[model samples]
Target: MLRTTLVAAMLLATTPAFAQPEPARVEVNGMHMYYEVSGEGPPLIVLHGAYMNIETMGAIIPALAESHTVYALELQGHGRTTDIDRPITYQNLADDVAGFMEAVGIGKASVFGYSMGANAGLQMVIRHPEKVDRAVLASVAYDAKGWQPEFLAFLPQLAPEFFVGTPVEDEYRRLAANPEGFPALVDKLIALEHEPLAWEADVAKIETPILIVQGDADTPSPEHAVAMLRLLGGGTMGDMGAPLPASRLAILPGTSHTALMNQPELLKALIGPFLRGETPKGMFD
Candidate 1:
Protein backbone atom coordinates (compact mmCIF):
# COMPACT_ATOMS: atom_id res chain seq x y z
CA MET A 1 0.00 0.00 0.00
CA LEU A 2 2.82 2.39 0.80
CA ARG A 3 4.49 1.66 -2.55
CA THR A 4 1.18 2.29 -4.40
CA THR A 5 0.74 5.59 -2.57
CA LEU A 6 4.31 6.56 -3.44
CA VAL A 7 3.68 5.84 -7.11
CA ALA A 8 0.53 7.97 -7.13
CA ALA A 9 2.43 10.85 -5.55
CA MET A 10 5.15 10.56 -8.17
CA LEU A 11 2.61 10.69 -11.00
CA LEU A 12 0.90 13.74 -9.52
CA ALA A 13 4.20 15.55 -9.11
CA THR A 14 5.23 14.83 -12.68
CA THR A 15 1.97 16.10 -14.16
CA PRO A 16 2.30 19.48 -15.87
CA ALA A 17 1.27 22.23 -13.46
CA PHE A 18 -0.63 24.03 -16.19
CA ALA A 19 -2.72 20.93 -16.85
CA GLN A 20 -4.67 21.36 -13.64
CA PRO A 21 -8.40 20.63 -13.82
CA GLU A 22 -10.80 23.51 -14.20
CA PRO A 23 -12.55 24.85 -11.12
CA ALA A 24 -15.89 23.66 -9.86
CA ARG A 25 -19.12 24.91 -11.42
CA VAL A 26 -21.02 27.71 -9.70
CA GLU A 27 -24.56 29.07 -9.97
CA VAL A 28 -24.90 32.37 -11.78
CA ASN A 29 -28.39 33.87 -11.92
CA GLY A 30 -29.97 30.43 -11.58
CA MET A 31 -27.73 29.01 -14.31
CA HIS A 32 -24.88 26.56 -13.77
CA MET A 33 -21.73 27.97 -15.38
CA TYR A 34 -18.46 26.12 -15.96
CA TYR A 35 -15.31 28.15 -15.50
CA GLU A 36 -11.57 27.65 -15.17
CA VAL A 37 -9.40 29.94 -13.07
CA SER A 38 -5.60 30.11 -13.11
CA GLY A 39 -2.56 32.28 -12.41
CA GLU A 40 -2.43 35.18 -9.93
CA GLY A 41 -2.64 38.90 -10.46
CA PRO A 42 -5.31 41.25 -11.76
CA PRO A 43 -8.30 39.26 -13.01
CA LEU A 44 -9.01 38.88 -16.73
CA ILE A 45 -12.27 37.40 -17.99
CA VAL A 46 -12.36 35.81 -21.45
CA LEU A 47 -15.65 35.36 -23.33
CA HIS A 48 -15.69 32.94 -26.24
CA GLY A 49 -17.62 33.35 -29.50
CA ALA A 50 -21.01 32.00 -30.55
CA TYR A 51 -21.17 28.25 -31.26
CA MET A 52 -17.96 27.93 -29.25
CA ASN A 53 -16.75 27.43 -25.68
CA ILE A 54 -13.97 28.68 -23.39
CA GLU A 55 -11.58 26.24 -25.05
CA THR A 56 -11.87 28.25 -28.25
CA MET A 57 -9.44 30.69 -26.65
CA GLY A 58 -7.10 27.80 -25.89
CA ALA A 59 -4.34 29.27 -28.02
CA ILE A 60 -3.69 32.26 -25.79
CA ILE A 61 -4.83 31.00 -22.36
CA PRO A 62 -1.41 29.60 -21.44
CA ALA A 63 0.34 32.86 -22.25
CA LEU A 64 -2.36 34.84 -20.45
CA ALA A 65 -2.21 32.49 -17.43
CA GLU A 66 1.49 33.28 -17.04
CA SER A 67 0.93 36.82 -15.77
CA HIS A 68 -2.78 37.42 -15.14
CA THR A 69 -5.38 35.34 -13.38
CA VAL A 70 -7.48 34.13 -16.33
CA TYR A 71 -11.16 33.31 -15.90
CA ALA A 72 -12.51 31.40 -18.88
CA LEU A 73 -16.27 30.90 -18.98
CA GLU A 74 -18.61 28.72 -21.03
CA LEU A 75 -21.49 30.95 -22.05
CA GLN A 76 -25.11 29.84 -21.79
CA GLY A 77 -26.36 27.34 -24.38
CA HIS A 78 -22.77 26.55 -25.32
CA GLY A 79 -20.16 24.10 -24.09
CA ARG A 80 -21.04 22.52 -20.74
CA THR A 81 -23.53 25.19 -19.73
CA THR A 82 -26.27 23.67 -21.83
CA ASP A 83 -30.10 23.74 -21.76
CA ILE A 84 -30.44 27.48 -21.50
CA ASP A 85 -34.06 28.73 -21.65
CA ARG A 86 -33.40 32.40 -21.95
CA PRO A 87 -33.79 34.26 -25.25
CA ILE A 88 -30.38 34.80 -26.86
CA THR A 89 -29.46 38.44 -27.12
CA TYR A 90 -26.31 40.42 -26.51
CA GLN A 91 -27.84 41.91 -23.34
CA ASN A 92 -28.93 38.57 -21.91
CA LEU A 93 -25.53 37.08 -22.59
CA ALA A 94 -23.81 40.10 -21.04
CA ASP A 95 -26.00 39.83 -17.94
CA ASP A 96 -25.05 36.19 -17.65
CA VAL A 97 -21.36 37.15 -17.78
CA ALA A 98 -21.80 39.88 -15.17
CA GLY A 99 -23.67 37.48 -12.93
CA PHE A 100 -20.91 34.93 -13.34
CA MET A 101 -18.30 37.41 -12.11
CA GLU A 102 -20.50 38.44 -9.22
CA ALA A 103 -21.05 34.82 -8.25
CA VAL A 104 -17.27 34.33 -8.27
CA GLY A 105 -16.88 37.38 -5.99
CA ILE A 106 -15.00 39.47 -8.52
CA GLY A 107 -16.20 43.05 -8.54
CA LYS A 108 -14.12 44.17 -11.50
CA ALA A 109 -12.04 42.50 -14.21
CA SER A 110 -10.50 43.20 -17.57
CA VAL A 111 -12.42 41.58 -20.44
CA PHE A 112 -11.18 39.96 -23.64
CA GLY A 113 -13.71 38.74 -26.16
CA TYR A 114 -13.47 37.33 -29.68
CA SER A 115 -16.13 37.33 -32.45
CA MET A 116 -19.62 36.92 -30.97
CA GLY A 117 -17.84 37.03 -27.64
CA ALA A 118 -16.77 40.54 -28.54
CA ASN A 119 -20.41 41.58 -28.75
CA ALA A 120 -20.93 40.26 -25.24
CA GLY A 121 -17.90 42.18 -24.03
CA LEU A 122 -19.26 45.36 -25.54
CA GLN A 123 -22.59 44.83 -23.87
CA MET A 124 -20.87 44.15 -20.54
CA VAL A 125 -18.83 47.32 -20.80
CA ILE A 126 -21.96 49.24 -21.60
CA ARG A 127 -24.26 47.78 -18.93
CA HIS A 128 -21.73 47.16 -16.18
CA PRO A 129 -19.18 49.84 -16.85
CA GLU A 130 -17.89 49.74 -13.25
CA LYS A 131 -17.15 46.03 -13.52
CA VAL A 132 -14.88 46.35 -16.57
CA ASP A 133 -11.38 47.79 -16.16
CA ARG A 134 -10.40 47.51 -19.83
CA ALA A 135 -11.69 45.64 -22.84
CA VAL A 136 -10.35 44.03 -26.01
CA LEU A 137 -12.71 43.25 -28.87
CA ALA A 138 -10.99 41.10 -31.49
CA SER A 139 -12.39 40.57 -34.98
CA VAL A 140 -15.61 42.44 -34.24
CA ALA A 141 -17.88 44.58 -36.38
CA TYR A 142 -19.80 47.80 -35.83
CA ASP A 143 -23.17 46.27 -36.69
CA ALA A 144 -24.43 42.83 -35.79
CA LYS A 145 -26.07 42.71 -39.21
CA GLY A 146 -22.59 42.64 -40.71
CA TRP A 147 -22.44 38.88 -40.12
CA GLN A 148 -25.43 38.08 -42.32
CA PRO A 149 -23.87 38.92 -45.64
CA GLU A 150 -20.68 36.95 -45.07
CA PHE A 151 -22.50 33.93 -43.67
CA LEU A 152 -24.87 33.92 -46.62
CA ALA A 153 -22.00 34.29 -49.03
CA PHE A 154 -19.86 31.60 -47.42
CA LEU A 155 -22.68 29.08 -47.08
CA PRO A 156 -22.86 28.66 -50.84
CA GLN A 157 -19.11 28.25 -51.20
CA LEU A 158 -19.16 25.27 -48.82
CA ALA A 159 -20.64 22.20 -50.47
CA PRO A 160 -23.69 20.70 -48.79
CA GLU A 161 -21.82 17.37 -48.83
CA PHE A 162 -19.06 19.02 -46.81
CA PHE A 163 -21.56 20.08 -44.15
CA VAL A 164 -23.01 16.58 -44.14
CA GLY A 165 -19.64 14.92 -43.71
CA THR A 166 -18.08 17.43 -41.30
CA PRO A 167 -17.76 17.06 -37.53
CA VAL A 168 -20.19 19.94 -37.08
CA GLU A 169 -22.73 17.61 -38.63
CA ASP A 170 -22.57 15.53 -35.48
CA GLU A 171 -23.53 18.55 -33.40
CA TYR A 172 -26.42 19.25 -35.73
CA ARG A 173 -27.53 15.64 -35.57
CA ARG A 174 -27.38 15.70 -31.80
CA LEU A 175 -29.56 18.80 -31.65
CA ALA A 176 -32.02 17.36 -34.15
CA ALA A 177 -32.20 14.15 -32.14
CA ASN A 178 -33.64 16.11 -29.25
CA PRO A 179 -37.27 16.18 -30.29
CA GLU A 180 -38.43 18.33 -27.39
CA GLY A 181 -35.67 20.97 -27.40
CA PHE A 182 -34.78 20.95 -31.06
CA PRO A 183 -37.51 23.39 -32.00
CA ALA A 184 -36.33 25.92 -29.46
CA LEU A 185 -32.74 25.56 -30.61
CA VAL A 186 -33.81 26.17 -34.20
CA ASP A 187 -35.80 29.20 -33.07
CA LYS A 188 -32.77 30.59 -31.29
CA LEU A 189 -30.68 30.46 -34.44
CA ILE A 190 -33.53 32.00 -36.40
CA ALA A 191 -33.69 34.89 -33.92
CA LEU A 192 -29.98 35.42 -34.36
CA GLU A 193 -30.74 35.96 -38.06
CA HIS A 194 -31.42 39.60 -37.21
CA GLU A 195 -28.61 40.55 -34.87
CA PRO A 196 -29.93 43.26 -32.54
CA LEU A 197 -26.73 45.04 -31.57
CA ALA A 198 -26.24 48.17 -33.66
CA TRP A 199 -23.09 50.27 -33.14
CA GLU A 200 -24.02 53.84 -33.99
CA ALA A 201 -25.22 54.71 -30.47
CA ASP A 202 -23.39 52.22 -28.27
CA VAL A 203 -19.96 53.15 -29.61
CA ALA A 204 -20.37 56.69 -28.32
CA LYS A 205 -21.02 55.54 -24.74
CA ILE A 206 -17.92 53.36 -24.31
CA GLU A 207 -15.50 55.17 -22.01
CA THR A 208 -13.10 52.34 -21.25
CA PRO A 209 -9.83 51.78 -23.07
CA ILE A 210 -10.76 49.67 -26.09
CA LEU A 211 -8.52 47.54 -28.28
CA ILE A 212 -9.88 46.37 -31.62
CA VAL A 213 -7.78 43.68 -33.31
CA GLN A 214 -8.49 42.59 -36.86
CA GLY A 215 -6.54 40.90 -39.62
CA ASP A 216 -6.40 42.71 -42.92
CA ALA A 217 -6.59 39.42 -44.73
CA ASP A 218 -9.33 38.00 -42.48
CA THR A 219 -11.88 40.77 -42.80
CA PRO A 220 -14.00 40.20 -45.90
CA SER A 221 -14.27 43.92 -46.39
CA PRO A 222 -12.77 47.06 -44.84
CA GLU A 223 -16.10 48.86 -44.50
CA HIS A 224 -16.95 47.39 -41.12
CA ALA A 225 -13.54 48.15 -39.66
CA VAL A 226 -13.71 51.62 -41.08
CA ALA A 227 -17.10 52.18 -39.46
CA MET A 228 -15.84 50.93 -36.11
CA LEU A 229 -12.79 53.20 -36.25
CA ARG A 230 -14.84 56.22 -37.14
CA LEU A 231 -17.25 55.56 -34.29
CA LEU A 232 -14.38 55.14 -31.81
CA GLY A 233 -13.35 58.73 -32.66
CA GLY A 234 -10.32 57.56 -34.62
CA GLY A 235 -6.70 56.92 -33.53
CA THR A 236 -3.14 57.18 -34.87
CA MET A 237 -3.01 55.23 -38.11
CA GLY A 238 -0.40 52.55 -38.54
CA ASP A 239 2.05 52.60 -41.48
CA MET A 240 -0.86 53.84 -43.58
CA GLY A 241 -0.87 57.35 -42.04
CA ALA A 242 -4.64 57.19 -41.94
CA PRO A 243 -6.61 58.81 -39.12
CA LEU A 244 -7.56 55.53 -37.39
CA PRO A 245 -6.17 55.06 -33.90
CA ALA A 246 -3.22 52.70 -33.51
CA SER A 247 -4.72 51.56 -30.20
CA ARG A 248 -7.97 50.68 -31.92
CA LEU A 249 -6.56 48.55 -34.70
CA ALA A 250 -4.08 45.67 -34.64
CA ILE A 251 -4.17 44.65 -38.29
CA LEU A 252 -2.21 41.45 -38.78
CA PRO A 253 -0.67 41.07 -42.19
CA GLY A 254 -1.83 38.08 -44.28
CA THR A 255 -4.17 36.65 -41.65
CA SER A 256 -7.75 35.44 -41.96
CA HIS A 257 -10.87 35.66 -39.79
CA THR A 258 -9.54 32.94 -37.50
CA ALA A 259 -6.13 34.55 -37.29
CA LEU A 260 -6.11 34.60 -33.50
CA MET A 261 -5.76 30.83 -33.52
CA ASN A 262 -3.27 30.70 -36.39
CA GLN A 263 -1.03 33.66 -35.54
CA PRO A 264 0.20 33.23 -31.99
CA GLU A 265 3.04 35.73 -32.26
CA LEU A 266 0.80 38.47 -33.58
CA LEU A 267 -1.91 37.78 -30.99
CA LYS A 268 0.61 37.62 -28.13
CA ALA A 269 2.31 40.81 -29.25
CA LEU A 270 -0.95 42.72 -29.59
CA ILE A 271 -2.85 41.34 -26.59
CA GLY A 272 -0.08 40.70 -24.05
CA PRO A 273 1.03 44.30 -23.73
CA PHE A 274 -2.47 45.73 -23.97
CA LEU A 275 -3.46 43.62 -20.99
CA ARG A 276 -0.27 44.72 -19.19
CA GLY A 277 -1.12 48.39 -19.73
CA GLU A 278 1.85 48.87 -22.08
CA THR A 279 1.52 50.10 -25.63
CA PRO A 280 2.74 47.71 -28.30
CA LYS A 281 5.88 48.83 -30.10
CA GLY A 282 5.28 50.53 -33.49
CA MET A 283 1.55 50.68 -32.82
CA PHE A 284 1.41 54.37 -33.69
CA ASP A 285 3.84 54.64 -36.58
Candidate 2:
Protein backbone atom coordinates (compact mmCIF):
# COMPACT_ATOMS: atom_id res chain seq x y z
CA MET A 1 0.00 0.00 0.00
CA LEU A 2 2.81 2.40 0.82
CA ARG A 3 4.45 1.63 -2.51
CA THR A 4 1.18 2.11 -4.28
CA THR A 5 0.59 5.49 -2.64
CA LEU A 6 4.03 6.79 -3.49
CA VAL A 7 3.77 5.59 -7.08
CA ALA A 8 0.36 7.15 -7.49
CA ALA A 9 1.65 10.43 -6.07
CA MET A 10 4.60 10.33 -8.43
CA LEU A 11 2.40 9.57 -11.42
CA LEU A 12 0.02 12.38 -10.59
CA ALA A 13 2.91 14.77 -10.19
CA THR A 14 4.57 13.63 -13.40
CA THR A 15 1.67 13.48 -15.82
CA PRO A 16 1.32 17.26 -16.10
CA ALA A 17 4.82 17.57 -17.56
CA PHE A 18 6.70 16.48 -14.44
CA ALA A 19 9.13 13.54 -14.29
CA GLN A 20 8.10 9.96 -15.09
CA PRO A 21 7.42 7.43 -12.33
CA GLU A 22 9.20 4.13 -11.73
CA PRO A 23 8.38 2.93 -8.24
CA ALA A 24 8.63 -0.47 -6.55
CA ARG A 25 9.56 -2.27 -3.33
CA VAL A 26 12.26 -4.87 -3.82
CA GLU A 27 13.16 -7.64 -1.37
CA VAL A 28 16.83 -8.53 -1.07
CA ASN A 29 18.42 -10.95 1.37
CA GLY A 30 15.09 -11.25 3.21
CA MET A 31 14.79 -7.51 3.74
CA HIS A 32 12.19 -5.36 2.05
CA MET A 33 13.78 -2.23 0.61
CA TYR A 34 11.60 0.76 -0.21
CA TYR A 35 12.60 2.89 -3.16
CA GLU A 36 11.03 5.60 -5.31
CA VAL A 37 12.19 5.68 -8.90
CA SER A 38 11.65 8.57 -11.29
CA GLY A 39 12.68 9.88 -14.72
CA GLU A 40 14.14 7.73 -17.50
CA GLY A 41 17.78 8.20 -18.20
CA PRO A 42 20.90 6.73 -16.61
CA PRO A 43 20.34 5.16 -13.21
CA LEU A 44 21.40 7.07 -10.08
CA ILE A 45 21.14 5.54 -6.60
CA VAL A 46 20.86 7.87 -3.62
CA LEU A 47 21.83 6.88 -0.10
CA HIS A 48 20.94 9.04 2.89
CA GLY A 49 22.90 9.77 6.06
CA ALA A 50 22.70 7.92 9.38
CA TYR A 51 19.52 8.39 11.43
CA MET A 52 17.84 9.60 8.25
CA ASN A 53 15.42 7.86 5.89
CA ILE A 54 15.00 8.05 2.12
CA GLU A 55 12.68 11.01 2.59
CA THR A 56 15.61 13.03 3.82
CA MET A 57 16.86 13.24 0.26
CA GLY A 58 13.56 14.77 -0.85
CA ALA A 59 15.04 18.21 -1.40
CA ILE A 60 17.46 17.10 -4.09
CA ILE A 61 15.35 14.34 -5.69
CA PRO A 62 13.21 16.43 -7.97
CA ALA A 63 16.20 18.05 -9.57
CA LEU A 64 18.03 14.79 -10.17
CA ALA A 65 14.79 13.13 -11.33
CA GLU A 66 14.70 15.69 -14.11
CA SER A 67 17.32 13.85 -16.11
CA HIS A 68 18.22 10.62 -14.32
CA THR A 69 16.41 7.54 -13.03
CA VAL A 70 16.87 8.25 -9.31
CA TYR A 71 16.60 5.40 -6.79
CA ALA A 72 16.52 6.57 -3.18
CA LEU A 73 16.84 3.84 -0.58
CA GLU A 74 16.06 3.63 3.13
CA LEU A 75 19.07 2.00 4.71
CA GLN A 76 18.56 -0.88 7.13
CA GLY A 77 16.93 0.22 10.42
CA HIS A 78 15.98 3.51 8.87
CA GLY A 79 12.49 4.64 7.89
CA ARG A 80 10.42 1.65 6.81
CA THR A 81 13.23 -0.89 6.51
CA THR A 82 13.42 -3.56 9.16
CA ASP A 83 16.44 -3.71 11.47
CA ILE A 84 19.13 -6.28 10.86
CA ASP A 85 19.42 -9.16 13.28
CA ARG A 86 23.17 -8.74 13.67
CA PRO A 87 25.12 -5.65 14.52
CA ILE A 88 25.43 -3.32 11.57
CA THR A 89 28.74 -2.66 9.86
CA TYR A 90 29.72 -0.60 6.83
CA GLN A 91 30.59 -3.67 4.76
CA ASN A 92 27.24 -5.33 5.54
CA LEU A 93 25.40 -2.15 4.63
CA ALA A 94 27.35 -1.78 1.40
CA ASP A 95 26.58 -5.34 0.43
CA ASP A 96 22.91 -4.79 1.09
CA VAL A 97 22.99 -1.80 -1.26
CA ALA A 98 24.77 -3.80 -3.93
CA GLY A 99 22.31 -6.66 -3.52
CA PHE A 100 19.49 -4.17 -3.86
CA MET A 101 20.84 -2.97 -7.20
CA GLU A 102 21.21 -6.49 -8.46
CA ALA A 103 17.72 -7.43 -7.33
CA VAL A 104 16.35 -4.44 -9.19
CA GLY A 105 18.15 -5.45 -12.36
CA ILE A 106 20.56 -2.52 -12.46
CA GLY A 107 23.79 -3.52 -14.17
CA LYS A 108 25.70 -0.34 -13.29
CA ALA A 109 24.49 2.81 -11.63
CA SER A 110 25.92 6.06 -10.35
CA VAL A 111 25.75 6.33 -6.54
CA PHE A 112 25.06 9.42 -4.46
CA GLY A 113 25.73 9.13 -0.76
CA TYR A 114 25.37 11.70 2.01
CA SER A 115 27.24 11.65 5.33
CA MET A 116 27.23 8.09 6.73
CA GLY A 117 25.66 6.95 3.49
CA ALA A 118 28.62 8.53 1.72
CA ASN A 119 30.94 6.32 3.74
CA ALA A 120 28.82 3.31 2.84
CA GLY A 121 28.92 4.40 -0.79
CA LEU A 122 32.71 4.37 -0.68
CA GLN A 123 32.62 0.88 0.74
CA MET A 124 30.32 -0.22 -2.10
CA VAL A 125 32.55 1.26 -4.77
CA ILE A 126 35.63 -0.28 -3.22
CA ARG A 127 34.13 -3.70 -2.56
CA HIS A 128 32.05 -3.92 -5.73
CA PRO A 129 33.46 -1.57 -8.32
CA GLU A 130 31.83 -3.44 -11.17
CA LYS A 131 28.37 -2.44 -9.88
CA VAL A 132 29.09 1.25 -9.76
CA ASP A 133 29.66 3.42 -12.83
CA ARG A 134 30.19 6.70 -10.95
CA ALA A 135 29.81 8.08 -7.44
CA VAL A 136 29.15 11.21 -5.43
CA LEU A 137 30.47 11.28 -1.86
CA ALA A 138 28.81 14.10 0.05
CA SER A 139 29.96 15.23 3.50
CA VAL A 140 31.85 12.00 4.19
CA ALA A 141 34.86 11.10 6.28
CA TYR A 142 37.47 8.48 5.51
CA ASP A 143 38.53 7.98 9.13
CA ALA A 144 36.44 7.33 12.24
CA LYS A 145 39.17 8.20 14.73
CA GLY A 146 39.23 11.82 13.62
CA TRP A 147 35.55 12.13 14.59
CA GLN A 148 35.78 10.67 18.13
CA PRO A 149 36.71 13.78 20.07
CA GLU A 150 33.79 15.89 18.96
CA PHE A 151 31.43 13.00 19.60
CA LEU A 152 32.87 12.39 23.08
CA ALA A 153 32.31 15.93 24.22
CA PHE A 154 28.65 15.89 23.12
CA LEU A 155 27.33 12.41 24.05
CA PRO A 156 26.96 12.40 27.85
CA GLN A 157 24.71 15.42 27.85
CA LEU A 158 22.14 14.11 25.40
CA ALA A 159 20.47 10.68 25.75
CA PRO A 160 22.10 8.55 28.38
CA GLU A 161 19.33 5.97 27.95
CA PHE A 162 20.72 4.94 24.57
CA PHE A 163 23.75 3.52 26.36
CA VAL A 164 21.36 1.19 28.21
CA GLY A 165 20.15 -0.45 24.97
CA THR A 166 17.21 1.72 24.03
CA PRO A 167 15.97 1.15 20.49
CA VAL A 168 16.90 3.81 17.94
CA GLU A 169 13.33 4.97 17.57
CA ASP A 170 12.79 5.23 21.31
CA GLU A 171 16.03 7.10 21.70
CA TYR A 172 14.94 9.51 19.03
CA ARG A 173 11.59 9.96 20.73
CA ARG A 174 13.28 10.60 24.05
CA LEU A 175 15.50 13.19 22.45
CA ALA A 176 12.51 14.75 20.78
CA ALA A 177 10.73 14.92 24.11
CA ASN A 178 13.69 16.76 25.52
CA PRO A 179 15.51 18.73 22.88
CA GLU A 180 18.61 18.65 25.04
CA GLY A 181 18.79 14.87 24.45
CA PHE A 182 20.19 15.54 20.98
CA PRO A 183 23.78 15.63 22.15
CA ALA A 184 23.52 12.18 23.72
CA LEU A 185 22.26 10.79 20.41
CA VAL A 186 25.31 12.16 18.63
CA ASP A 187 27.54 10.60 21.28
CA LYS A 188 25.87 7.23 20.86
CA LEU A 189 26.41 7.46 17.10
CA ILE A 190 30.06 8.34 17.55
CA ALA A 191 30.53 5.58 20.14
CA LEU A 192 29.11 3.00 17.76
CA GLU A 193 32.26 2.76 15.69
CA HIS A 194 33.25 0.51 12.83
CA GLU A 195 36.69 -0.79 11.90
CA PRO A 196 38.40 1.81 9.78
CA LEU A 197 39.28 0.95 6.22
CA ALA A 198 42.60 1.93 4.65
CA TRP A 199 40.88 4.55 2.53
CA GLU A 200 44.05 5.63 0.72
CA ALA A 201 44.62 2.08 -0.45
CA ASP A 202 40.96 1.48 -1.27
CA VAL A 203 40.50 4.84 -3.01
CA ALA A 204 43.46 4.12 -5.24
CA LYS A 205 41.52 1.15 -6.57
CA ILE A 206 38.46 3.13 -7.66
CA GLU A 207 38.43 3.63 -11.43
CA THR A 208 34.98 5.21 -11.70
CA PRO A 209 34.41 8.95 -12.01
CA ILE A 210 33.62 10.54 -8.64
CA LEU A 211 32.40 13.86 -7.36
CA ILE A 212 33.20 14.83 -3.79
CA VAL A 213 30.92 17.53 -2.40
CA GLN A 214 31.41 19.11 0.98
CA GLY A 215 30.05 22.14 2.78
CA ASP A 216 32.20 24.89 4.21
CA ALA A 217 30.79 24.19 7.67
CA ASP A 218 30.82 20.40 7.63
CA THR A 219 32.04 18.97 10.91
CA PRO A 220 35.59 17.63 11.47
CA SER A 221 36.76 20.33 9.01
CA PRO A 222 37.09 21.14 5.36
CA GLU A 223 40.52 19.52 5.30
CA HIS A 224 38.76 16.13 5.14
CA ALA A 225 37.27 17.11 1.80
CA VAL A 226 40.66 18.22 0.55
CA ALA A 227 42.14 14.92 1.67
CA MET A 228 39.49 12.96 -0.25
CA LEU A 229 40.11 15.00 -3.39
CA ARG A 230 43.87 14.57 -3.24
CA LEU A 231 43.52 10.86 -2.71
CA LEU A 232 41.09 10.48 -5.58
CA GLY A 233 42.70 13.06 -7.89
CA GLY A 234 46.04 11.19 -8.13
CA GLY A 235 47.87 14.08 -6.34
CA THR A 236 51.46 14.48 -7.56
CA MET A 237 51.53 10.92 -8.84
CA GLY A 238 50.94 10.31 -12.55
CA ASP A 239 48.52 7.78 -14.12
CA MET A 240 50.76 4.79 -13.36
CA GLY A 241 51.13 5.66 -9.66
CA ALA A 242 48.04 4.22 -7.89
CA PRO A 243 46.22 6.45 -10.32
CA LEU A 244 43.08 8.14 -8.99
CA PRO A 245 39.88 8.15 -11.07
CA ALA A 246 38.34 11.11 -12.86
CA SER A 247 36.91 13.23 -10.02
CA ARG A 248 36.09 16.71 -8.77
CA LEU A 249 35.70 18.19 -5.31
CA ALA A 250 33.37 21.10 -4.77
CA ILE A 251 33.27 22.98 -1.45
CA LEU A 252 30.09 24.99 -1.28
CA PRO A 253 30.29 28.38 0.47
CA GLY A 254 28.27 28.87 3.67
CA THR A 255 26.94 25.32 3.62
CA SER A 256 26.85 22.59 6.25
CA HIS A 257 26.08 18.89 6.71
CA THR A 258 22.53 19.40 5.40
CA ALA A 259 23.61 21.29 2.30
CA LEU A 260 21.47 19.25 -0.04
CA MET A 261 18.31 20.05 1.89
CA ASN A 262 19.06 23.70 2.57
CA GLN A 263 20.74 24.72 -0.67
CA PRO A 264 18.88 23.10 -3.54
CA GLU A 265 20.17 25.50 -6.19
CA LEU A 266 23.77 24.83 -5.29
CA LEU A 267 23.15 21.11 -5.08
CA LYS A 268 21.54 21.08 -8.52
CA ALA A 269 24.24 23.35 -9.89
CA LEU A 270 26.85 20.75 -8.99
CA ILE A 271 24.96 17.49 -9.62
CA GLY A 272 22.66 18.29 -12.57
CA PRO A 273 25.33 18.77 -15.17
CA PHE A 274 27.52 16.06 -13.76
CA LEU A 275 24.77 13.43 -14.24
CA ARG A 276 24.22 14.72 -17.76
CA GLY A 277 27.90 14.15 -18.57
CA GLU A 278 28.39 17.88 -18.96
CA THR A 279 31.14 19.65 -17.06
CA PRO A 280 29.94 21.82 -14.20
CA LYS A 281 30.99 25.39 -14.93
CA GLY A 282 33.23 27.57 -12.72
CA MET A 283 33.77 26.58 -9.03
CA PHE A 284 32.13 23.20 -9.38
CA ASP A 285 34.68 22.28 -12.04
User: Highest lDDT, which number?
Assistant: 2
Sliding window of 10 residues with minimal summed lDDT for model 1: 1-10
Per-residue CA lDDT of model 2 for 90-139, tens digit only, reads 67778999999889899999998877688889889989999998888877
Candidate 2 residue runs with Cα over 4 Å from true position: 1-23, 145-152, 155-194, 234-245, 280-285
Give all candidates' CA lDDT scores: 0.63, 0.64
Clashing pairs in 2: 158-184, 159-184
Model 1 has an lDDT value of 0.63
lDDT of 1 by residue, 1-285 (tens): 001111112222221224453666888766678788877789999887654555545556666777788898877665566546677777787899899888889999999887667778888888999999888887776565444365545433433243233333343334232324434543564465355547668877677777887667543245666667667766544566554343366676775565444555567677777776774356555
Model 1: CA > 4 A from native: 1-18, 145-149, 152-166, 169-186, 236-247, 280-285
lDDT of 2: 0.64
